[model samples]
Target chain A: MLTGWGRTSPTAATLCAVHDEADVVDAVGAATPERGILARGLGRSYGDSAQDAGGIVLDMTTMSGFTRDGSTLRAQAGASLDDVLRAIVPEGYFVPVTPGTRFVTVGGATAADIHGKNHHVEGSFGAHVRRMRVVTGTGEVVECAPGSDAFAATVGGMGLTGVITEAQVDLLPIATSRMRVDTERHADLDALMAAMTQGDHQYRYSVAWVDSLSPAGRGVLTRGDHASLADLPAGTDDPLAYDPRPRLGAPPWMPSGALNRASTRAFNEAWFRRAPRERRGEITSIPAFFHPLDGVRHWNRVYGPRGFLQYQFVVPDDASALVGLALQRLREAGAPSFLTVLKRFGPGHDAPLSFPMQGWTLAADIPARIPALRDVLDALDGEVIAAGGRHYLAKDSRMSAQTLSAGYPQLARWRAMRDALDPRGVFASDQARRLGLTLGSAP
Target chain B: MINAVGQAQSVLVLGGGSEIAGAILRALPAARLQRVVLAGRRSSVMEERAAELRGRGIADVETVDFDARDTASHGAIIDAAFDAGDIDIVLLAFGVLGDQEALESDPAAAVDLVTANYVGAVSVGLHVARRLRQQGHGRLVVLSSVAGDRARRANYIYGSSKAGLDAFAQGLGDALAGSGASVLVVRPGFVRTTMTQGMSEAPFATDADAVAAIVVAALAKGRETVYAPAVLRPVMAAIKALPRGVFRRLPG
Candidate 1:
C-alpha cells in the first residue's frame, strides 16, 4: 500500500526502485495502458501526486548520486537535498533554494518547483536548474534546457511528461552554515501583514507562523540570511559546520485526536509567547533557521491515525484581504489548524504548473477528522479561486477539477506540451487522474 | 487504479447486466474512470448497459460474452479482460435465485442452480483472483446473500449454493492477503433485482441501489465483509445461533 505523508487516502501499487535510466525505461515500457507509470522521489509530496495505484511506481531514490565541479552541482533526481547539503556545505556551497524540509529529493523539488522562505530573494528551486535529463514516455532519454518545452513542462508537470533522472543545478556560495537571524511577534493579522509587506525585501529569508485558533491571529515572524565569516563570534570552530539529525520524534503508535482544538491552541499560545518581541543577529544553525520542523522525525504522525490535510493556497499581493478573510472564516467555523505558515513569493518559474507567483502563500495543517473540515475547505476553495489564487498540487488531496483549472490558467498550454511528449498517456498518477490531467482533453 | 478521491480507473463486472452492479458503477466518480468492461451471457443487453454508462460519462465501455454456465470458457474470458489492461475492480455480480419449488422437484434444475451459483462462481472467482494477485493490486467484490446464513426449506438449493460461494470468497480473500489484492464479500438480504422482482418481499427486502451504496462504501474502506442494510448482520447472526429444530420451524 502506498500513501502520501498525509495518510488520508491509501492505494495499492507495484513499487519498484529504479537504479538508472535503463531501469526507468524498461519499467515504463513494460506498463500496459491501464497500468500507467509514475516517478516517485523520497515520497515527500503531501498528497496522491506520488502514488499511482494498480500501476507502476518507479521509486527514483535508488538512482541517487551527487557530483560537483567548482560551484556547479550535478545530482541524480533521487538524491535528497540533505544528501547534497552534506556533501557541499563544508565546501562553502548550498542549494540555491531549499524548502522547509531538506528531506525532499532533487527530482521531487524539480517536479514541484518548491519555493522556500527566501523565495522573495532567490525565486523557486527550478530557477537555479541549468539542465535535466528526462526519460520520455517513449523510453528515450532527452537532455533539456530552460528554453525547451519539455524542460518547462517537466519542471512542474508533476512527472507527467516523463521521469527526471538527474539535473545540473547552480549552487549558492556561503561563508558559513550558520544563519544570522531576527525574530519578532505580531499581535494580530493586520500587524503581521503590514510588517511583512513593508520590510520583507530587506531580508533574504522571511516566514511567519500564525495561530489560526486565536481571533487576534497572533504570530511569530522569523527572518534570516546566511552568516558571513565576519558576523560569526570570534574563536568559532568549524563555522561552516553542518549536521542534520532528528533530536526527537513522535512514537509510531500515537493515538488519534492528539492535535485537537484545545491542544493545538495551547501549543500555539506557548510558541507565540516564547518569541521575543524584537531580537536580531542571533546566530543559528542552518537547520535551526530554515527547517525547525526537521529536528523532529515523523512530525506529521503527531496529527495521529486519521492523518491530516495541508491546505496551501496563494493569492496575488494586491488581494491580501482574502488572507485575513480566510483566517476569519476558519476561526468562525471553529476549525483547528495545528500549524500555519505565511511566506512571500517573488515570481513563478517557467514551468506552467509551478505553484508560486508574486503573492502571499499560506499553508496550514488541519486534522482530517474535523467535522466542518470539508465544508470549510470547499468554501475556501471558492474564495481562493475567485481571487485568482490557486492551491498547491503537491499538498492537496482534495481539490475539485473546476478549482484546479480556474487557478492554473496555463493548464491548456501545459497539457498540449504533455500530449506532444506523452501521446500514449503512459505517465500517470492519482493526482493527474483526479484533476483530469491525463484526460488530455478535459474542458 | 482508484484515485485518491475514490475514483476507479477501470472496472470489470462479470454479470454486466446486474442491476446492483450497474448502480455501483454509476456511483463511482465517472470523470476519472477511463474504461469499463461488462461481461454477461447476452452481449446485446450488456451492450445496451454499456451505452447507458457511456451516456452517464464513463468514457470507454466494452462488453464481452460471458455465460456463467460455461465454466470451461471462464478462464479465457477473464484472462482476455485483464489482458486488455490492469483491472482496478471485478464485480462477481452474476447469480440465479431460481424458483425454489421447481428446483426441489427437478433433479436437473437443482443441479443447474448448484453449478451456476456455486461451481461457476468459484471457477471465475479464482480466475479473477489470479489476475488481481498478478497485477499486485485490485479489488474483487463478491455478492453473497443472507440466504446462506442458515438454509431454509423454501429455498434450500439456492441457499446451499450461496453458502458454498460465501465460504469460497472468504477463503479467497485470505489467500490474497499479502498480495495487495483484496476481496469484499457483500451479504445483502433479498436485494430486489430482476431475479427477485416477482418474489414476495422478504422481511427486510431492499433494492439494488441501496446494496450498491453499501458495496461502494465497503470498497472504499477496503472492508473484508459487509452486510447490506447492516441490520441483517445481527439478524443473521441470531438465525445462525438458533437450535437446528428452532431454525427448521422458522417461516420464510
Candidate 2:
C-alpha cells in the first residue's frame, strides 16, 4: 500500500494480476505523464524499488514483446522469467540466473539489477545485458549499451533514471532444462558456505536451502548447473529441445495450505533425500531445473492473508560469525522462514551501484508476523553493512534506508548520476521515499 | 508484428482511474507488465483500480494523490517518480468532465473545469515535456477526444478544453520528434461510462475495455493520433472541416 507519493500504508500491495508490457507502457503514456513515472515488479521489494508513488509507473509486463537473434534474446518490459523460458528453452538457450522463481519481468531484472545463486560466478543480470532501450523521464526512447555510463547507472540504479522498455540480453547455450544437482546436508552455516565456495566453479548455478528452524547454523546445501550433453545419455535427438510440459498440476496459493510445519518439513526432507546420489546423470526440461517453484504460480499467496516479507541480506565472509547470531535472533523471536536461500557471493561489480559483493547472501520468505522479524532484519542489515556488504533491492521489502545507505556504499554515486540524468527526480518510488533514497542522501 | 518477447517495459498511468487508460492497462498480459501506479485525487478510487491490476498478476500496483489543479508541486511529483527508478512511459491522464449544466449554473465550477482539464494539464504537461526532453526518450499519451474536433454549443467548454489539449499535445509531439520521444493523442467518441451518464449514446460508443484495447494498439505502433472508435478518425475530420456557422445551426 502507498499513501501520498512516498507515504506507506499498513496494508501491503499485492500482485493479484498479470499485465502486458505494452498496455502498461501505453497506460503510463496513457496519460501525458505530467509528473513522470517508475516501473515496479513483484512488489516483493519493501521500500520503493518498484513504486514511483506519486508519479506514473510504466507497467512493462504488457510489452509481452519478444524476439531472438543468434544467441541474443530480447523481450518487452513486462515479460516475466517464466515467459522468457517458455519461449526460448525449447529453442536451446536459458536465462542467465533466474531467481528462485520465474515470475519477475525483464525490466525489473534490469532496473533492480538482480542477482541469483550463480552471482559469485556470473555476476548480476546487468552483466549479461548487452543493450537496453529506455524511455526517459522526458519520453525519449534511447538505447544504452553496457559500456555507456547511462547504462551502468540505470542498470543498478533501480529504475531511477528512466524506464527500460526492452533489452538485448545475452543468452546461454543450454543442452537441456534438467540440472545435474548435488545436495549435501550441512551441520551449520559455516559448512554451507564452505560447500558453496568449493562447489561454485564446478557449476553454473548453485543454491542452498537453509533450515532456518534448526539451531543457529544448520541448513541444506544444493549445487547444480545445466548438465552438458556429454553428461547425459546418448540420445538420438537434440536433448536441449526436449519440451518438458507439466505432467501433473502443482497446487495454487492455498492460503497457508501448502506451507506449515508438517508439510514444509516433509517437503524439505523429501527434497534433501530425493536428490539423486549419482550426480552422474539426469534429464529434465528447462523449467523443471531452473524454475521448479515456478510450477506453482502465485506461491506468495501461500503465506496466507497476513502476507509475507522477503528479507534478503548479504554480509562479507568475515561476517560468518554473525550467522549463528542471526539464527539465534530468528529463533529467539520464533520467526521461521517458509523458504530460505543461501549463496556465496563474490566481489561486487565496479558499476558503482551493484548489490552483490565478496560475501554471502541469504534470503528468507517469512510470514509477516515473526515478533522480532523487523528488529532482527534491522540488526542483520547493520551487520552486513559493517562488513561492507549490501542488500538486494529486488527481494527486499523491509530494510531501512539508512541500512540501505550503509549496505550499498555507492548509493551516493549512483544517486548523483541519477540526479544528473534526471535532475527533476521525476522517477521516485515508495521504497526510495520511505528510505529517503533521494539524490542528496545517496552514497 | 511488434516483437514483444523478452522486451521488458513499464507504464505508469498518472490518473490510473481514468477509464480510457485503465482499459489499456488491462489488455496487456500480466507477466510482462511491471508496475501500474494510479495517481489521482481519490485514494479509494486509485486503490480500486490498483486492485484490479493485482488481480491480473500486475502486482506492482500503487496509488498516490495528484490534484490536476495542484500546480506548485508538479516538479516534486515529477522528481518523486524519477527518484523511484527509471521511467519509460508517463501518461498524464488527469482531467475533469464537468457537467455543462453545472458549469453554467455555477460559473465558478466552469473555472474549476478549465483549470483541471486545460490549465492544470498544460502546467503539468510542460513540466513533463521538459523533463522527458532532458532524459532524451519516452512517450506521452494524452487523452484528447472527438469533442476536441470542433466545439459546439452542446458542450463548448469541455470540447474547447480538449481542443486546447489536442493542440498542445500535437505541438509537444512535434517538438520531441527526433529526441527519441513522442506524443500520442487519443480521440474517442462519447464513451459509455460514468462521464456520459445523462447523454444519449453516440455512434460507435464503446466501453472502457474497448477503448483500452485501441489505446494499447496505438501505443505499440507509436501512432501519432488514435481515434477510439477507429471509425471516428475519418468522421471527426469531416466534422472539424465543416463550415462553423452552418455547423452551429444544426447541432443541439
Candidate 2, CAPRI quality class derived from DockQ: incorrect
What TM-score results for chain B in every one of the models? Answer: 0.97, 0.91
Q: Residue B48 CA error for candidate 1 (Å)?
A: 11
Chain B, candidate 1: TM?
0.97
Name the TM-score of chain A in model 1: 0.98
Best by lDDT: 1
Q: What is the TM-score of chain B in candidate 2?
A: 0.91
TM-score of 1: 0.85
For model 2, residues A1-443, the per-residue Cα lDDT tens digits are: 32211111221222222254344345444333333466765444433366443355554555667888879988877678777787787788888767666777788888777887788888888889988887665546678897777888888777777777788899988876567767677766777777777777787667777777777466766667787777676773766564534444434434533455566657656665665433433445556656666566455556554455666677788776655666666656666564777787766766766777777777766665333455566667777677766777765555555677777777777777776666555666545554556637323
TM-score, chain A, per candidate?
A: 0.98, 0.86
Worst lDDT window (10 residues) for model 1 chain A? A434-443
